[model samples]
Target: MTEAPATIMLNGKSRKIKQPCSATELLSELGWKPTQVVIEHNGQVIPRSETGAIMLREGDQVEIILPVAGG
Candidate 1:
């Protein structure tokens, strides 16, 4: 039997993602680059260098913020 996809709370919305996904992988799946945004996992800000090491679990809360160019 196939395993159910993991569900995470992304930006306050429910999103289904593959199992064993890392923060970096999530970014890739969302068509985003690591350098282009900041990530907050479970209410904590995740450093860019640590994104690859952080694994995303079901019910995880993630917030992705992109830097604005305008003043």
Candidate 2:
């Protein structure tokens, strides 16, 4: 049998990940560059330097916002 996926709330939507992973890894998997985005984990803002250290958990809430440039 395979391991059940972990579920987390991402940007108000539910998402399933294969396993628990660092916030950095999750961002990488989603094709996001840590330096270009802001991450909020469980209602706490995560600094870019700490992204690699924050491990994601099941039922956790995460919000990722990318910077927009307009002229």
Candidate number with greatest TM-score: 1
- Tell me the tens digit of each residue's lDDT in model 2 across 12-42: 9999986658899999999999998999999
Candidate 1 achieves a global lDDT of 0.93
Whole-model lDDT values for every prediction: 0.93, 0.91
Question: 1-71 in candidate 1: lDDT tens per residue?
Answer: 66678999999999998888899999998899999999999999999999899999999999999878787
- Report lDDT (Cα) of residue 34, candidate 2: 97
Q: For model 2, state the Cα shift of residue 20 in Å.
A: 2.6
lDDT of 1 at 7: 98
- Candidate 1's displacement at residue 22, Å, is 0.5
In terms of lDDT, the poorest run of 10 residues in model 2 is 16-25
